[model samples]
Target: MFDIEYLILIFRDEFNYFMMKKVVKLLPLQHRNKDCVAIQFDFNDSIKAAVMKVGAKWSKTHTCFYILNETKLKQRLFLSLKKLNCFVDYSAMPKVDQVKKSVNKEASLPKSHAHALQVFEDYLIGQRKSPSTVHTYRNFLNLFLNYYAKRDLASIDLRSIEIFLEQVMAKRGYSVSSHRQCISALKHFSELNLGMKYDPANLYMPRKDKKLPVVLSSTEIVLILRSTKNLKHRAILGLLYSSGLRIGELLKLKLGDVDLERNTIYVKQSKGRKDRNCSLGQRIRPMLLNYAQTYQPKVFLFEGEEEGKPYNATSIRQFLKRSCQAAGIQKHVTPHTLRHSYATHLLENGVDVRYIQELLGHSRPETTMIYTHVTERKIDEITNPLDSAIQKFNRMDNETPNPLLSRNENK
Candidate 1:
């Protein structure tokens, strides 16, 4: 197979060896006082049986599973984690998997707003806000607090907050998105945290213009794949294009979510906390298998250098940018561009728009209908009226041989 043709192979594998395999979502956190390892895992019979086999118990306090973290059960616990691909690689003696033993603790907050930030974080967790939201909202709040470090929380009102937003917009020259995010954070802090109402004017932000997503051609996508040399990077590009995954969804992928045997990827806990199955490209199957065997990613299909964490969305963006440059695709493409292209190309291939909606995990058909406007397939099918008229006139002249024109030509 030539370079780009490598992406066109079809694979058939009926047996699901990964069916029983479990993904350890959050690798067990060792709670010394609790004397248990708090493990977050996808629910499966095999996993439950493993927990029972270890005499492990569930902890409501931590909202996770607890295996007795004693020397007696340590080996058994590590073995149980094998299904998650998180066991220590005994081949490397000097180090072990941090997921099995280490905790990913957040950095300490500044002293000025530590207590208030803690309250906000606790509130977000209690409300079951997604991790990304918690991080973003917390950062925004931190900036707000940092702007007026000495201002008393109770004394500060909407007027003071509006000034801070003005500064953010004017001095920082940030977009409306940031300005709106700041307003949202302040609102959350005031209403939810401080139990105070903010003025409506302080919270108001102008609506942003809706921009259509960029879609790449299939040939351009192939060129990008051909340009990417690393196996993992290629697999990432292939999966992004083939599955039409959002960057967040791609990052959240667990080893268990990929079922090569079924040629499907289960997208769990997406935008609306909904799980959906997406098609796995048969051509990319071999690439995935190779990455799985070589990288041995634990907890996620693709992981960061950090032991337990999934691949960072920002880094993947950088990879795409570089791949685009190398492929000489001038269009400003992001990860979502591939997704838009996927939907558009599927539409071109005569796939029903409604089915495309499900594939993209859009709840509303209207949201999916936007592709119809941009799809060149429909536009390409349309013939120009002038061209048709010219063709008809030419045919008539050729067949009937207009006498005046024929006489002039003979003269």
Candidate 2:
């Protein structure tokens, strides 16, 4: 959550002082483990004339001073007082400033659990993790932090983290891979932001179930592209499939990023905020150039109706859904599917894993290697043991007399 104490620093007068009479002190302390206010002040007689006049009026209402209105006064008043320069001599008035300072210090100190999230985001932007990976990390952090608000990050034991993971998996119905991702994000955040080392030795990442990456056949991909005839829709899908661009990267593209002559498109601030150049297929270059001429987009490549701005990520997804429905493709295909198909096709065409890594803007070659496993080369070579056994049985049957013929002769 965004910090609230800063608001208090901006609005101090109406809350801490009554006319000329200043509240001598205010302290935040716990009563029955609940937040409660402790206040102190001087009477009118002890102050100067101006201060006295205001003090008399304030002194008349003793009950008002102590009983903070939970609805109207309690929290906002404290916030407001912080704003009005009332903390000028906070240290001189140790009774009030000391307590407030402690609170401020606590607020400034980054929460260990929360710091982990920021660190992971930094890595994502720097390392250029895939959009899906970044999104999953963000969702996991938000859910985890929202679950444990105002709790001391250092005090949270391993058991707490495990329990939270279990709740997400068992009660929240998260897959094992998702659970592991949540753990990975949190662990990175803690180590980078809070200086809390999460040793992989003691902590076991949940075994991720190995699943094959789904790839559409070349014919099916062509069919989907053909189904979407509109220039904008076609361009979006074309860029995704042809360049292996993520939907977010495609949506964030600026017009200048596309170099028509060189047949390269620059991806800026991608998954890890890393910029890279992706090849624009010569085939789509004319189509894109034509669309550019028709649209005349100002900044973003894919202009929307609102004065040529790029289409939002959500809108792009909506367009893809509409296009899929129009194409009558039975499989549930998204823009990312186009990217997956692109990578698989590259592998099938004998593009080296190292080269694919650079084209896909993957930080590690291992990540790009997953596409190799999804290619047709592996699937085509897969021979079933049962097929060999069946062939042998057929050969034996042909060499020997048929069982039916032998039985008929005996009869």
Candidate 3:
């Protein structure tokens, strides 16, 4: 029954061997390394011998040594000095985390009924609407909603839309075409989202001006064709006159749609997505064949610079503009002018109105009848008031004045 005093030792570094007098404790030699005590201590040989007498096991892991005692054990636990690196200190970190947090907060803030917009977009895509059309419609609705953030869908009445259209016209100076586009987008959105038909009566859409289609004279058409330096331009203008093709129809022509043997061009999925066959004259067939051979376009009849890409309508329109300016023509000529000229020339040549209608792919013959109003011979054939008065004057000059009126007026 003896108590032994022991010293606690802690090593700073294994190689340096710096020992420090950490603590001291007392314990019975017989109780060293005993299982009765739950906690144990470890130290060097001198410290181990003192703790082992008290039934405590030595641990190589700890950097400190412990002394066993009757009530408590004294130990100095050596901890490695942690060197502060880039990540350990908050101030040393980049500003990216703060920016990211701010971004996340703003992004998570809902985009004015995001769920509703997503539903509308999905419905539009499901209906096989064109991607551009879908984007336009979706953006229109988003602008409307974001502009009037306070108003709910139920609160957005016909009157609200009407007022918005007016504001758009007055403030944005949108033309009839643009106004119609806005109305169209909203109408589709309302149909899909609110499950209600948008009545045109509810909206005060601007009246689209009824401008007569510009028709090129046959002489002007010839001049425009002759001004073209490239085979492509010549062939395009020729086809425009030959097939009565709108620029859109011309650009959409695939390689296989042209029939060289029959001298015909197939207009696939035209304006109203209707397909029609148009005659290709034997005259322009050689030009077309030459253009085909020269360009060697793989897919589209008129391949653009981007490999197999089809000729864009806008580019073709610009080409026509440049060609018209070069030709020194005073008339405002468009690709559509060639189409109008084709119809007007046909009508003047005594082609049946119904036949012209069929050739131009007009749904109704009445639409094609406008050419009749503009035909030169049709206008000249009508009896003029001047001609009637001239005949009466001629008869009087040759024979006598009106006897009763002339005699009475003299008296």
Candidate 4:
């Protein structure tokens, strides 16, 4: 009997330890008046560290870590934790589809408003606007319609538009770019649907902010690339910086677009719907060759898990964030920041701005000229006036004796 009891105790302890290692609970909770998903697990230092790495915040009141209850974030959290062999139990939370339904119900427009938006979308399509542009314009028009749901679309005048813009700016805190897009969408919609003439004077367009692009130093770029352990991820970062490809352009790249022998990447239908050839770095060539052999992508250069499908932009961003963290870079880095760094570095290397403009597929030289402001080339070449003055003063002081010191010695 003593032997049997001892065996039972050992079994129970092992089971508890296994459960602690395997199970992670996710429950819906209201955190700071916002719906959040709380991550609850038994005390495990490794698990806690992993959750924190995934950007979950420890809530003191709730006594658990929580993240904003977003679908993408929830999926990311599940995948990230699952990689650690943890079984994420989110059974306590509502299904994603159910949540989306509730949100759609709350924001659904009336039939008349919906019809008007459909017409505006059709008009945008007829005008040959890009799918993304059409989607943005339609969404903005939908917002405008909902704001004036009871009023007729024909009744909206300049004052009404101005009022709506003011309310949106105050409530949603739209950025300068978003505000400008909103104005453009409204102007186009009114001209096409409401038979209003395009008059810039009547509509208020916010001035574009002249904020300089964030640039990573060459050393930081090297560190980011080196810190990325995955070959595919490193290749993505390499292509972005070496070839100066936009995230969208990079995604659209086919296998044939890359010329290893010529050391050029053909960017097709880039910004402004223009195709251009960009220089490829000799250093990245061998990595690409290795990645190609390993991945064996058929259609796109960098295919996702599913064959022929492009790798996700969000995945690139997520892994890039991890790489930056691993590299100990604190700057707010994004995929676009790599592009900016590419342009600035090239300018620093004495590349012509016009050539950069062509490579970047910028329709105007002025757009590419922005990098000139951020490049340190000219600034590094010019010495500071203060330094010059200090050097001159030091030379004079060393060359001549102090009169005050001589007088004091005589006294």
Candidate 5:
């Protein structure tokens, strides 16, 4: 039947007679049309059978078969054509064999949770928060909704909320920031959106644990720097350490931002949309110039494979992990560790804590003071208090002759 179908089509179009035995080209339609995959093919009997099996419909407007741009249909079509050995071009369609799980920090939720999240998102946006903040808020809301899926939203009492938070802390091991976000999401969503009162006295956010930022020792930092032979990687590590720029700030850096002449890197629109000049050491400037000569990054200082695309955060993390292994210093080193070490090392070198705060772009001096606990200044390396006190006591004893007339007797 397919042979007859092909022969009739061949007779109608003379060009079909000279066409290839089997070929399939997937083309994406533009100009405000994205509902179909325009699959153009010249087919043999087996290929025709496969197409018919997948219910490919010929569209006169498109001049090709319109396979609904859908996952199941695409999967079935690909599977049926697998045996034919026909050239299948999937350049137009992203592989949908597995639904790529969204990189949400929260657990995956069902569709019902999305409806609740939409309202929460609208409320956040209405508050004029940044888009990234709103997205993070929405994910936190999703986790809350997932946790209380069985309960009526309005009927959720304070006790249940407490239990849920405990589960997040104990079972999920969510960080303090995550826990805070969750509390904020629930409070706003319930009080503002659902018209339910969220009594903070009943369910209070946990106090943040007094944990020190993990910092690499100065020697370990040098080892990691020396181990990373790639010029781009070294510059990235060095710039991060020298300037104390956040990972996001580092990735967003433009070539024009690095001012080696003034020995400053202009950090633009950092965390709070605030700009500041971070000091770049004379040491890393030569390396930066060499890297510029080699890589020739057009726009962003740290570019990915394609031009103008910022190098991904994952790449930086991977580079740090690999560098740590090679340097034989493993303390769960992340890219942020480099920034932490930079701040702490600066503090250790007698740079004022206030100046370190400014360099780190920290909003609060208290936040910067956390590094002081970890840094061992020259003052800290002085003689022990016990030894100093003992020496002073012995010198006094040597000077004194008797309790009644000690001063003159010693002279």
Candidate 6:
């Protein structure tokens, strides 16, 4: 009897250990138009409850529990699950380091192409192109070079470039914007390296799809701002809306850029590499002061976990989504939406379009004019033609009086 009881106990212990070691996979999924990490595992009540505690939600469409796929949130979920003795398999998820390594590995070029690419890169850097622009142009040039690796670089003409672009579009499903960038990249390369002077009129570029910017109403904006309880988060969203700073520009802000006395924020080398000053809201002054004291940022206005590093934009986006959800907002809101709302609100308040242009740092007036179409100020003032015509007909009918009604009254 003692031997049989001991064997049963050992078997139960082994079974429990195996159950605790069950694997749960975290998958990349697009849920409700937002990137989310889906937690997939064999159904277990305990694991489900634990995942819920870590803020994972069930998606009917995807048939899995998911959480916002931010770095910090992923780390939190991993740690939380580990504490519950759940094995997490996150190998399927993409990592920034892995992506960088993959890109580096794929960057091989032939000897001739490598020399030309180097020369082109040096030229771009010498011309003071932004890092992103240089990287894009180099990648496009590399693709073109690799396609015609056997042919002489100087021998390539506009016709060959067109064929390459057509093939790429068909294969990769390139959008109009990407197609335009590829053209621009090739044009620059042809002019600089191949000594080709192609006429701009000859290049047939596709028209860009016109889509209006989404603007949140003042009440909704207020709700979103009020819902954000964290001072740092509130300040970030507040600055984005109040000053109309682009996400990149906001992330690049340093303590020295803000001038409390002048009530202005110096935006240095923004889009188009232009520097501009934006008005600082008096309301946000106290908040900024309090945040500065609380956070005690060493370098950038908003630093990440490590000192002197600019705060991760992904973190800002993650918190903004949470704030919008807490505010009961259903719209797809992004950081740029705040900037759009800022411009539209300014336009509705009778601010000159030219002044709005300067504030937004737009190179052309037409770019600022887009806000005019979206502003509700003029739209609200004008009555609909159908409504006006209906009202007039009703008044005329009442005054004329129906003949049948008159006859009936006589009877």
CA lDDT scores, all candidates in order:
0.74, 0.66, 0.66, 0.84, 0.76, 0.84
- Across 1-411, the per-residue lDDT of candidate 3 in tens digits comes to 333432222232432332233233222221222212222333345544444333344333333333233233222111110110111112322255544563333234246556667778898899888777787777666656655556666676777777777675456555677667678777667665453335655666567777677888788888888888888988998999988988878888999999988888999877656788899989898898899889889998997878788886655666677678788988877788999999999988888888888788999877888887778778889999977887777788668756532345645
| Residue clash pairs of candidate 4 | none
* Position 17, candidate 4: lDDT: 71
Tens-digit lDDT string for candidate 1 (1-411): 365545443211212344434555434343432335565666767666676556565655567766654555667766776855442323312134443343222233445466787788788788798887788778777767766666667666777777877886546655677677666666666645453336655566758757777889889999999999889899998999999999889998998898988999999989878899999998999999998898988798999888779986756776777788799999988889999999999999999998999999998998999899789899998999987887777788888867542255545
- Which parts of model 2 have CA positions greater than 4 angstroms off? 1-155, 168-170, 175-178, 188-204, 393-411
lDDT, candidate 5, 1-411, per-residue tens: 578889888776865533432567776542112356677776466776577557665565566676656677778888777667566777766444322332232335545565677777888889877788897777666767777776666677778778888886446656787788778777777756463445865668778888888989889989999999899999999888878888999999998988778899898888887899999898898999999999999999989988999997866876777789899995978888888999999988889999988888889999998887888785478799878886777777779843432244544
Model 1 error, position 157 (Å): 3.7
Better of 3 and 5 by lDDT: 5
Candidate 5: the clashing residue pairs are none
TM-score of candidate 1 versus the correct structure, residues matched by position? 0.61
Clashes of each: 0, 18, 11, 0, 0, 0
Supply the TM-score for candidate 3.
0.65
- Candidate 4 error regions (>4 Å): 1-107, 193-200, 398-411
Worst 10 residues of 5 by lDDT: 98-107
Per-residue lDDT of candidate 2, residues 312-335 (tens digit) = 665566566666767677776777
Question: Clashes in candidate 2: how many?
Answer: 18
Query: lDDT per residue, candidate 4, 378-400, as tens digits?
Result: 77888999888877776786888
Ranking of candidates on TM-score, top first: 4, 6, 5, 3, 1, 2
Q: How many angstroms is residue 343 displaced in model 2 relative to the true structure, after the best TM-score fit? A: 1.3
Q: How close to the true structure is residue 306 of candidate 1, measured as C-alpha lDDT?
A: 89
